[model samples]
Target: MRIYLDNAATTPLNREVFLAMEPYFFENFGNPSSAHHHGRGAKVAIAQARGIIADLLNASPDNIVFTSGGSEADNTAILSGIRSNGIKLAITSAFEHHAVLHTLQALEKNGEIRIVYLQHDAQGNLSLPHLEKLLSTNERAFVSVMHGNNEIGNLNDIEAIAQVCKRYQAVFHSDTVQSMGQYRYDTRRLNADFLVGSAHKFHGPKGIGFLYRNAGQALYPLIYGGAQEQKQRAGTENVTGIVGLAKALEISYRNQEVTRQHLLRLKERLIFKLRDRIADVDFNGNSANTGQSLNSVLSVSVPDPNTGISLISYLDQHQISVSGGSACNSHSGAASHVLSALDTPFGRATVRFSFSRYNTAEEIDYAVEKLAKCYAKPGVSAYAEGLLL
Candidate 1:
């Protein structure tokens, strides 16, 4: 069936978004940096796209700064925000994407800042009191928490978290890459200083995304020298990608409710089948909770951890693709930071099966059948319940 269940890593580009970008790539190809007619046209197109994105979040076009993708946007937000605001301490969770974690780590390594991790329960819920304590004692702190956990699909209460951050006057930056298109965001009430989005995370083209900086926030330019991005980001803009992103985001918002409801059904079906077909099967974090977890993600824990790679390969051989962690971090064969933070059962394999609007019930059935077959293979009885690692 060749089913793709890894939308969290990146989604296939939407046809409408592709068509929207075609004109910009050829007949309308012009450097937005130039001051000619063609350049002016491209500039206007970019401005229109920016306005659409800003409108989606109830933000101003002036607050949107386009970037390569979520990673770049996260990097720019963290470094620039800290430098410009004299933020010396940061609050984050152990399960945060490395985009935010690594940046904070580097800064802390160089004595640029101090980091405190928020307390989280086994189900990946944060302790609000812990956040309140950390925020209360820290001055000019940078808080980097994602809207949803990429590995485990636990959705955070950004609004509640934002309230605490506001009380402490902390600069809050959320990596909204995973939740941008799937959920609605109203910057008018989000109470955040910065939010980031990546087009590829939705159904838009790769290599383009944006950072939403509140009007009053001061962020230094991570990239040096260029009048582009209103002097915020350097280098020429990616006009085509920017257009596709805008179009894709528009489509996502338009179809968000229906798509979300449909994918939620697929997830529920997969969960039911996983339990029915496999022995001692379990899920990580809030992935099994439709109301709390992301509607598109399901992180399954099988009995055998040593066969993690084999299972993925076996599924690939059957033309069904899934993941063990974020595409960026899974190849290292190390446990996912998110799962590790939740203290997932020792030696149990974790397979993340994420979905998008394109997936179907038939594909979900086939994936479950293949997964059960993979675990039932001969001579691996050590995976039996009593022998669990």
Candidate 2:
């Protein structure tokens, strides 16, 4: 039996979401921009979907601008939110996803703005006091902070961060891609200038997401051409994907409590079993802290730094799929920047096992059994230790 514990990378398409999107792919298909009967129907579907999503987040439909995915939404929020406001300074943490981190780096490379990286502890908790200090010290700045760490599963206190930014009168943007469907977000109460969501992260269709631009943000278009997305994003609307996204988010909210309990149980079970079965097993960041981190994600560390990739390969061979870090950087063949930034110990190998509603207790037990066996093998642990000596 193949067990997939990589929900953080992307989830399988939800059945209900697929059904909602089916009509758009066939009989009801039409370009939403057109004015004929066929086009009007498609346009209605898109608008309804937008309304559903907006209602769920307590955001205005006009504020939700569709994008290709989280990366695009992040880029849009960072570049447009910065340039359109005439801001020249930014603040973020090293734990941010590449989407936000790389975008700020590029801006700095072009001599467009200065970036102030907020201090973080080894457990990946960012300093909010430091954030306040930075904001007070700098001019009006664009602040990009993620709602959750994709690799370490650290949940940043974005609400607190948003409050600080508001006090400083700075623009705040959060990459909520990981925590979108998992957590409840009322944009009005949160008072963030921008927030982003990706459908694939929440069992919706891939290649579809949205940017929540607060009213009167005056953000310009990242893509230019058509009048789609209320002249903010310029491309033909992704009607099918939009329908899927709305349906998926609706289902997520309707069943949010049950899903939360299920995921938390699975995460706790995996943590307990791994600790009981493996010697010196540890968790990175606040992932082990149920109260602070994402219940869907857990980053496990074993006492063998050299075995990060090797252990992932072993698990794959045993029909258990997991990841050493973010799937986005898996092919880079370099150490995880998040782990590196935290100065993760040299003798520990890390693996991120993310859960979904589909994962079962039996699968958790099976994965732990395989991991225990891998460590039990002669020279598997000893060999790595020998190399360190």
Candidate 3:
């Protein structure tokens, strides 16, 4: 079986979620906006799913607005939060997901708002003091920071950052796409104005996600021409996907502790195996620091840039799958913006192996074994000799 270690990109849909979504596909398929019985049934299903999600998040049902996925939710939060609030200044980190960075950059280009990127240390940890300093000087700025780094697995102290934003009266939005299913977030206590989740990231169906806009926060619709999402978003809801997302999130929260423990074991095993088997292997960002990183992700850096470039394809040949960093950057082969922001060494190759509850210790060992072979000295392995055809 192929060792699938790219859960950060997406996860296999859970059987339970699939089953919960089955009826919605055909049996109950109807436009949620319709006024007939079929429409009411579909609308009720959406409401129940919304309630399940909101309750799980300890948030009010009205605060949750469903979108196509995390990208859409992120776009809605940044654009609406900034525009509706009339915020002219913004702060974000250099390594935020493109959804946030690019959107803000577009606004900056249009001269709608000026943005300041918060600096970070060599470890990829954002400087909260600098964030506070910027917020203090700016006039009611919008701040977008993520709870977890999708590429490097650095977990930011968003709660503390939220407090700082509160002190400066700045609107804070955190892209929690990577952190959502794995961690418990009580929106009532999070102190942020906006947060995002993508169903596909946590074993739910793709094409669905939710945006949590705290009570009293003003955000205009990202989509127009319909009353869906209480008019916060417009379109016919994806009933099947919505049902699956709710089911998937429920399963994730129910098994979160068990899943976390299992993933931690797998991650630690891989980290130990990689360090012991490779000569010049290291890690990027805070990925290797369990206390400060996502438990499911480990970003390994090999000394040889050539190996870094070829290791993934070599592993693929051996029935192992991994990534250089974010799947969004996998095709480009460009150095990850996250790693670049940290000034990672120029000659090293970085591989990100993300874990899930489905992963096993054997798969971890197998992946590392093949990984070490890829690093073999020049004549010892074909890949090491730059001989792969």
Candidate 4:
């Protein structure tokens, strides 16, 4: 049986989500921007989906803007939030998803703002003191931080971070793509100016995501043409995808507690089994603790960099699907900047095993068992160890 544990990358579409979206594919197909009976049906579906999501996050429907995916949502939140406020500086953590990091970098490259990277601890925590220093030392600042590190699964204290931003009077944005389904978020309680999410991250269809822009934040559009998303995102809305997204969010939240417990146990099982089966095994960030990190993700650093094929490739050969890093950087031909920035041993191989609600304890065992065989191969572990010294 194939064991797929890369939910951090993307999840399989829930059957319920598909059924919710099925009618929009052909029967009620219409462009939301058009003004006709067909178009009215599509528009209502999109509005209902947006309202459902807004209710879940405790935000007004007008505050949520649909985007192509997390990248666009993040870019919209960061760039627009920065420029809208005439911000001169941007601050972010070293472990943010490229969607946030790269957007900050591009803005810096264009001389729009100076970028400050907050200090990150070995446990994958961002230093609030460093953030305070940067904020106090700078002008109006735009800060972007992710709720969870995609690679290491470190959960940042967003509420604390939001408080700091409020104290500094800085604009704050968080990429909640990884944590939205796993944790509960109340925009009223958390005062972040912007929050972003991708539907695919939570078993919804891909190519659909949302950016929650705080109700009084006057932000401009990234895509401008016709009036859609309140003229904030100018493109025909993905009606089917939006409906799927709402249904997926509903299903995830319905079982969030039960799924959380199940995934946590699976993570702990892998942690102990890896230590028992492999020498010098390590878990990145605070992912070893379910309470501290994302319960679904465990960044496993092993001693083997098997020749001929990668550790991920070896696991794939054994019908276990995993990833070396974020799927976004899968084809970037670059090492994980998150791990590298943390001064990780250059020789070790890191595999991100992100679980879903569907993953079972038996599947976890099978992955670890297959991993043992991969390490048993000639020159795998020894090679990784020899280079460590």
Worst 10 residues of 2 by lDDT: 380-389
TM-score of each: 0.95, 0.96, 0.97, 0.95
Predicted candidate 3 versus true structure: per-residue lDDT over 43-75, tens digit per residue: 999999999999999999999999999999999
Put down candidate 2 lDDT per residue, 1-389, tens digits, no spaces: 89999999999999989998998999889999999998999999999999999999899999888899999999999998889999999999998999999999999999999999989888988899899888887789899999988898999989999999999999999999999999999998999989999999999999999999999687667789999988889999999999999999999999899999999999999999998888778899998999999999999998663554477887898899999999998878888999999898896789899988899999999999877765664436533554322
The best-first sequence of candidates by lDDT reads: 2, 3, 1, 4
Candidate 4 global TM-score: 0.95
Candidate of highest TM-score:
3
Best by the lDDT measure = 2
Q: How well is each residue in 57-132 modelled by candidate 4, as lDDT tens digits?
A: 9999998888899999998888788888999888888888888888888888999888888887777688999998
Worst 10 residues of 4 by lDDT: 380-389
lDDT for 165 in candidate 3 is 93
Query: After superposing candidate 2, which stretches have Cα over 4 Å from the reference?
Result: 305-309, 377-389
Superposed model 4: Cα runs more than 4 Å off: 377-389
- Local distance difference test, per candidate? 0.88, 0.90, 0.89, 0.87
Report clash pairs, candidate 3. Answer: none
Per-residue CA lDDT of model 1 for 1-389, tens digit only, reads 47899999999999999999999988889999889989999999999999999999999999899999999999989987788898898889898899999999999999999889989888989888998988776676888888887888999999998888888888889988999999888998988989999999899999999999988887688787889999989999999999999999999999999999999999999999999878778999998998898998899998773643466776788898889888997678776788878888886778899999999999999999877865564445433533323
Error of 3 at 371 (Å): 0.5
